[model samples]
Target: MEYISFYNGNEMPIVGLGTFRVENNDECKASVKHAIESGFTHIDTAMIYENEDKVGEGIAEGLAATGLKRSDLFITSKLWLADYGRENVAEAYETSLKKLGLDYLDLYLMHWPGTDEAVMIDTWQGMEDLYKENKVKNIGVSNFNVEHLEALLAQVSIKPVINQVEFHPYLLQASLNRYLDVQNIHMESWSPLMNAQILEDETVKAIAKEVGKSPAQVIIRWNIEHGVVVIPKSVTPSRIEENLEVFDFSLTAEQIERLDKLNENSRIGPDPVEYSGH
Candidate 1:
């Protein structure tokens, strides 16, 4: 498993399993358990998904099944929009921790920027308190653009360790990534697989043929090579394992250029331009 060292010196897996729509308790538990069994140590979930408890059950079963310790896995959860204020954030984070049944979260992030600046600042303060109290190892933000990042940067003492967004071949986000790179802030991809359409993309397929790898592997490898932490979710066991089979090969400069041309500046989720934070 490849890793990316954060600005604070903590190591994060380059690839992780995303549990966004894995709501069914049995299915979620099985998917995570299968992932762990297949050597995946990182798990991503959020309170907005309302599946943290099920995720916890899966993690517990996976640990028991594999005999892996808590420190071996990178477990991340996010605070929802409804719990955006300072007071509410503190309580909400505690609730998530309890539901996850973990002593300390590996990483906790603001699910969204939210509509209130004061609330966002307060939430960061709460995260700072949690870090000081040894409740969370790192703190970050999600779905925040450059402006939002600037806003958070101006007020917080501890800079956000990461910013996760919906990134894929269609939405390249090169400019945003450059800005984040300047700040030494790591970027994570939520929908890294882009609904598996890369498999059907002519450019990606061409690269796959040239590289003797699948298109899925090519795009995923591109993400890792570009230094982005990606979580490509899959309920199928074969797809889950195939997603991790990207470590052995590398993409050529020309192939990367071709793939870069595939970006359409499209977003599968909410538009950040009109986004009033959340």
Candidate 2:
């Protein structure tokens, strides 16, 4: 497995399993178990996913099935909007940790940048506290744009190690990607596959045929080659295994340029600026 070393010197698997809509306990548990059993070392979940307990169950079962210790895996969860305040953020982390049956998280992120900048600043303080207290190994933000990142960086003592966003061939986010690169912040892709839309694209399909790989593999390899961490979610055991098989092949510079040109600035998820949930 490939790893991305954070600014703080912590390394996480470049590829991970994302649990977003895996709503039910039984399915979530089984999916996580299957992922680990299929050789996945990193798992991503969130407080909003409402399956932390089941995810915890899956982690327990996966560890038991694979004989892997807690330290052998990298687990991540996010703080929901409702838990944005300084008082509530740490509590939210504790609740997620308790639900996941773990004492410390490998990484914890602010799910979104709330509308109010001051509130987000306080939220960062809470996350910083968690890091100081040894409750989380690293802290980051998801769905944040350039303005949000600048605000946070200007006031905070610790810089976020990552800025996970809705990145794919369709929504390239080139400007944000460049900003993050300059800041030395890693970019993580939440919907790296664009919910299967990219699989049907003519260009992607043509590239897949040329490379003798699946469309999913081609897209995933593109993200990896761009130095972006990708978490492609799948409940199907075969796909969970297949998503990890992207390490074998390499995409040529021309092919990568072709894929890069497919960007249209489209988004499958909510826009961070207008999204004001709490």
Best TM-score among the predictions, by candidate number? 2
Tell me the lDDT of candidate 2.
Answer: 0.93
Query: lDDT tens digits, residues 1-278, model 2?
Result: 99999989999899999999998569889999999999999999998999899999999999999999999999999999898889888889999999999999999999999899999999999999999998899999999999999999999999999999999999899999999999999999988998988899999999999999999999999999999999999999899999999988999999999999999999999999978873
After TM-score superposition, the amount by which residue 197's alpha carbon in candidate 2 deviates from its true location, in angstroms, is 1.0
Superposed Cα deviation of residue 47, candidate 2 (Å): 0.4
Report the number of backbone clashes for model 2.
Answer: 0
- On lDDT, the candidate that comes out on top is 2
Give candidate 2's TM-score. 0.98
State TM-scores per candidate: 0.96, 0.98
Query: Poorest 10 consecutive residues of model 1 by lDDT?
Result: 269-278
Alpha-carbon error at 81 in model 1, in Å?
0.5
Assess each prediction's global lDDT (C-alpha) against the native.
0.87, 0.93
